[model samples]
Target: MKLVLSQEQRELRAAVRAFLGAASPLPKVREGYDPEVYARLSGELGLSGLIVAEEYGGAGAGFAELAVVLEETGAALLPGPFLATTFAAIALAEVPDKELLTAIAEGRIAATLAQPSIDLIADEVAGESATVTGTLAQVLSGMEADVLVSPALTGDGVIMVAVELAGEGVTRTALETLDLTRGQARVELAGARARVLGPRTEGGVGDRLAVALAAEQLGVMRAALDAIVAYAKVRVTFGRYIGSYQGVKHKLADMHCKLEQAESIVRYAAWAADESPGELPEAAALAQAYVGRACFEVARDHLLLHGGIGYTWEHDAHLFYKRAKTDEVLLGPPRVHRARLAESLGL
Candidate 1:
């Protein structure tokens, strides 16, 4: 498979990076979710529609392109419903609802998946209706989503359902998290009205989500490595650059190696999503298993290398560290993914 990015993809990455550099600076990101910024990302950059089909008002890009955009978002620590909306779109695209796809592509609505529980059954059920109960903890962008794509266990099987958050019996409470740029919330669904999408598969949506998250982690790792390296080069200690020291040089070298490895794994996962659906499950699992912990380590090293300044809230080092920690467990811990990878490998 091709590992290099196409010219168009490179250009798209540059444009997205430039936009986020200006609009999503650390201060703006810390301010929390801004609907206006979301609108601009959707309307001006057409990011909301990145992966949707052209007929549905999207750019009709593949997972690779989507990965590029997500990487930039992660680096900028953009706060909003972007991840939720994108994940919803990825799941919904499998359904036959053209209207919902169109709405999402046009940025008319925001959506996210309610974290499925162990029971997997709807808390309450009636004729053609399901009530989702239980609190979904750490739902990314859960508070601001207009729609929640959730799964409910029914008599037939586990079926994906679309629940309107504006409807009754649904309560969304914002939760404080380590990474402010990525908002989290607790969603309480009490007999929430819902529409069935289709039967849920074991690894369908989860694989896609993992690949997307890996892409984000790749961005975080790269940004952290770059920041630390830049600081090492300029910061002087004892009449010599800190980077000139063997210990510091080795740390930076290790961070670069990890970043490169993570990038390759993430790119392969994204490519597998589009080019080889059958390979996506293992690819995604492998990406998360390695990249998740690697990114977190890189971020941690970044903070440590920065010495005193990195610990402060004012500096950007902590933001990346927080994001890396949160993302490391967002889907599941690295061990979880490693277990899946081992199973996939028939071990």
Candidate 2:
């Protein structure tokens, strides 16, 4: 229940912010949403090894560190496979295949995930290489990925498989998205090769991914809240700062409170995912519910704070706004999270 961050955590946030400021300024970020920029920075920042353990060419940091780093990454709006890659790392961490983990931790390999198909089952993951056909469109940084984690049928159930992006009969194409600042790509799988990493039968990857996506939502919540707070003070209205207005101040305060609540759940969810994977499905769904809607609301308020100018192409608020909406459906909508929460609660 402690609201304060540890000294190390605060330092981590500052260090990441400083690094992004100097290494990848907003001006540079505005230049393009190229994943390569983030990819290279991932190496320069040693982020490729973020989730991998010391035994697998990583710094051996836990998900607490992942949350911290990702919060910074979200604030900067750095477009890359960061969330997907790190989540992929979680499954890879359990992989007996040390070579694959080493490749990603060493920055020589990339792994991104796509939305699970209609056939993807939340439970029952086990067995050998499976068959998967069709395509995943709008995969974040999918084209640059060396691997893709997808759900495929394994006998009576569906499970997660790590497929080589360079596999035979696989095709990749870059895409333009609603939010141009984030890279997207289409992946066509026709007789694509696969490696079974983890299964729902053993450890439900479908739920695991929901947990990971929730962590990223927490990051987005932080960024949108911060951006709106910063905007409120500087933006002028009625011959004074809009932040001084009673209505605006109250609204911003509500956003801050909601963000704090979401942050609490985010920390707990991250802790659960790292220290107690069993509690993931419920914890993740809970966090995503508060986080998903809170971020969209905060970002929308941020856009409105800018007045008519908020609708313009020049403002960064709209960018965050768009990204927030996009991420809302990254794993599924808020309604999906709510329904999952209800199911978890057995109601």
Candidate 3:
């Protein structure tokens, strides 16, 4: 299927890019989470509600539109709980929760998926309430989230639950991370009360999250490549531009090729998430498998091209590098996606 951004989508991308460029400069992103910026992005830009239905006080857009916004946010290194909130919204939208959806759309409450590294299943479940007892090693925006959408093993099957983070038996500790722009937290849930949403079927919310993250990786790769290209044209060595060298030129070309491939895969994945549900599993896996590693390579090459300055803390190259590495492992990494792709293909 052909994937091309419509005129409206292009306009949306331009607007988001412009807004982020002005509002979320590199220094601002390094300062950590900004509530004011998050408010503007959700309230004014309506980004948090991009994929929510109109009846739920959202824009009623599809995953394709959400992909566009995420790509721009990634390029700008805009921080906060955007990804977590988006994933939570996607999960909540599947259930009949008007109040939660409305609050999420209005940016009144933030939520995230609480998948622990220790186990995918909840510690215990009795009746309608589930008890989550474990330390979630990495929770994106967990500290700021008001609610958490988690998967718990039940008598019937694994089920998704919406738990209030402020409830008793929940503790959130912010963690220092490689990418300060994207905040993370360690969450400990002990007998936390949760409202059951529904069954956790195969190829469900996880696939959607994979596609969304792939879109974000595309943004990171593109931004890193663009920055390096711009620098290559101006930075000179031995009385000649470094970009004039065949080695540097070839590296840039390879990076560009990878970026293009990643873009195509992410677009298809996003489209499949909206239109063809059956294809989502394969598409998401392929997108993550290719885009994740592609982004890391591009970001690493970008840092190398910048020479010593790229290695320094002052330069923004390091930030992108750190983000790429973090994102590589965020949702199971490239290897995991590749394995999933193979399994989906029966190979």
Among the numbered candidates, top TM-score falls to 1
Off by over 4 Å in 2: 1-3, 33-36, 118-132, 154-160, 196-204
Q: What's each prediction's TM-score?
A: 0.95, 0.87, 0.94
Backbone clashes counted, model 3 = 0
- Can you list the residue pairs that collide in candidate 1? none
Q: Which residue pairs in candidate 2 have backbone atoms (N, alpha carbon, C) closer than 3 angstroms, thus clashing?
A: 124-201, 125-199, 125-200, 125-201
lDDT (tens digit, per residue) of candidate 2 on 73-166: 7777776666667767776554445777788788777788666563332222325565567677667778667798766665655556777888
What is the per-residue lDDT of model 1 for residues 57-133, given as tens digits with 9 covering 90 to 100? 89999999999999988888788889888888888776646777888888889988766453335745555567766
**How much lDDT does candidate 1 score?**
0.86
Q: TM-score of model 2 relative to the true fold?
A: 0.87
Model 2 — which ten-residue stretch has the worst lDDT?
118-127
Candidates 1 and 2: which is better by lDDT?
1
Whole-model Cα lDDT per candidate? 0.86, 0.73, 0.85
> Quick one: ranking by TM-score, best first?
1, 3, 2
RMSD to true structure for each model, in Å? 1.8, 3.5, 2.0
